[model samples]
Target: MKKLFRKILKYGLYTLLALFISLNLFVILSGRFYLYKGIANTYLVGESGPTIYDLDVFAYSTLEKGQGEDLILAQNYNKQKLSAADRAFMESMETKAFLVFKGDSLIHEEYWDTHDKSTVSNSFSVAKTVVALLISIAVEEGKITSIDEPVATYIPEFKNGGREIITIRHLLSMSSGLDWEESGKNPLSDNAESYYGSDLYGLVTRQKLITQPGETFNYQSGNSQLLGFILEKATGKSVTKYAEEKLWKKIGASHDAYWSLDKEGGAEKAFCCMYATARDYARIGQLILNKGKHKGEQIFPMWFYHEMISPSALNTADGIKNSRYGLHIWTYMAKSGQVNYCRGIKGQYIITVPGEDLLIVRLGSEREANITLDPARKGDKNYIESVRNKVGHASCLFHYLRMARTLTK
Candidate 1:
């Protein structure tokens, strides 16, 4: 009986070890090393998953400050406050920073969980707009002659496949028609590859065209990263360096921004991962609000800004027109006005209300489970309730705009 018990224990231990080895082998063979990283940085560290503060995982290139004047946004802390319910909602959403600028003056500013005015967090997909801005700047300077130019013009390897027909306009409008389905939870997803895998160029250029370019609006991070590569190819400068020379210097940013890389001296993860304070982000908001002008200096072309803000007339799966996205920017109709904004995956928003001259920046880790950060969590409810004609935009966003209007008047 003693020998039998001992044998049983030994076999149980062996079986567990074998299973663990098999899991590791499967992960390694599947090109999903990010799973290992995800576990180590998340579950092992007592986190549910990656948070905004996980920027240290990768090396970064700094957008070194040039001659940025202090941002024109005058700071007027505590001039107003959100309603208690709104504040509770923001707090529950794990807000790190909430800032509101009415015209040129900051009316309300608050922070939570040790995050301050200077706390730099991951910008996630908000960097997409930055990419758009860079593309326009390149165009304005004749570095990129036309948005209608074939992507193959810069990346020669794309010339053979159906990818050759994909234009910069398609990418900007999220209508590239690439065979990429973004999913953060799926270790095997294209987003996982772009976010965690080492070869951005190989991952992006190799995608097969599944749908005809410019026929529909299917949001894919690969589109933005591919544009990043094109920006590099056209401007003859790294994305970070070009942004420094054009955007940061022109806007007079108050903080040094960092763009995470796939590896040392590698491509900037331009689909996401720009890190900067919320205050600096509002500087960008003011640029959009002012239509390419930064306190009197024209930072970007006004026509380009208009083009960037105009929504692409692409059909959704249901054949409804896509009103949510513009050329790398996003829009939703708020009761106050149309809200054009840059968004990151984990609730990072740099919003501009053009009609009211309001700029709001909200940065945090969680948006809401109902809004589906993981894509798999997307619900059956397709459209959000709205005061105007339904835009079919993010339902979660309505709260922010409502709160902004409710701020002490």
Candidate 2:
């Protein structure tokens, strides 16, 4: 009996070793090395995927502040009260921060789960808005011709493979039609490579044009990363430096923000991964409220600012209007009027009610998964079933908007 048990153990060990060898070999040959890193960072760590708290997990470039400090302070800071129900909602969501800013002052601020006002968490895809802003700055400076220019002019790899027709405008509108899965769940998807793999340029350039550009709205991280590469080529500096010199310093941000790179001295993860405090993130709303002005100086050109908020004439392949996502910033028109917001995957939001000068910032660990079309408000001309925007608003947005309106009133 002892000999038979030893024989079973020996065979099992040999089988496990062989399986491990085959897995590593396949990972190398397929160039899916990110799969191994993903496993180590996620499954082995007892987490499902990357969280907003992962700033130190990767290398980053510091976005330095200029020689100034214009703090955001209000007499009513933390004076605004939250109802028990609203507080419970935030607490149950594991929210790190929730702040409401009225013009240049913070009216309400709250943090949970050991987070404070100075906590700098990952800003996920909210950084996409930052990339869009940087591109606008490049155009304003004439570093590039215009948003209409073909991407091939910046990245030579885009010159072929049906990618030549794709213009900067298409990418800004999330209509690049690049063949990217954009799924974080799939270990082999392009999203995994973008987040974990080292070669950002190669992964993006290798993508094939799956459809004609500017026809339909499709969200993909690759489009944002491509814009990052173009921004670097056009302005002759890294996105972090350009942002620091141009927007970050001008916005009066107190805490330093970091943009994660694929590696040290590598490309910025322009699709997402900007680490910043909630107060600093709220300044984006003030910049918008002032019509792209900081300290009374125009930070973005009026034409470009208009483009950022204007409704796109594009639609989903299913024939639904895609107005909410315009020039990389999300918009919603409700009874409280139009609100523009930048959203991250983990429920980080910098929402601005442009008409009322109200800005709401929320950072947290979860977001609504089933985002569906909301009922049309006062100014929705195309509110019929035929043109109802099924992708306009997430349910959580409405909750936050309601709370903001209630508190402000």
Using alpha carbons, what is the TM-score of model 2?
Answer: 0.91
**lDDT, candidate 2, 194-313, per-residue tens:** 998888999899999988889888888999999999999999999999999989998888888999899888999999999998878888767877778988799988788888887677
List per-prediction Cα lDDT, in the order shown.
0.83, 0.85
After superposing candidate 2 on the true structure, give the runs of residues whose Cα lies further than 4 Å from its correct spot: 1-19, 68-72, 373-392
Q: Which pairs clash (backbone N, Cα, C closer than 3 Å) in model 1? A: none
TM-score of each: 0.91, 0.91
Which window of 10 residues has the lowest lDDT sum in candidate 1? 380-389
Candidate 2 clashes between residue pairs 3 or more apart in a chain or in different chains: none
lDDT of 1 by residue, 23-126 (tens): 89989898677677666777788976557887898878999766656544455557666778887888888888988878878778889989998788999999
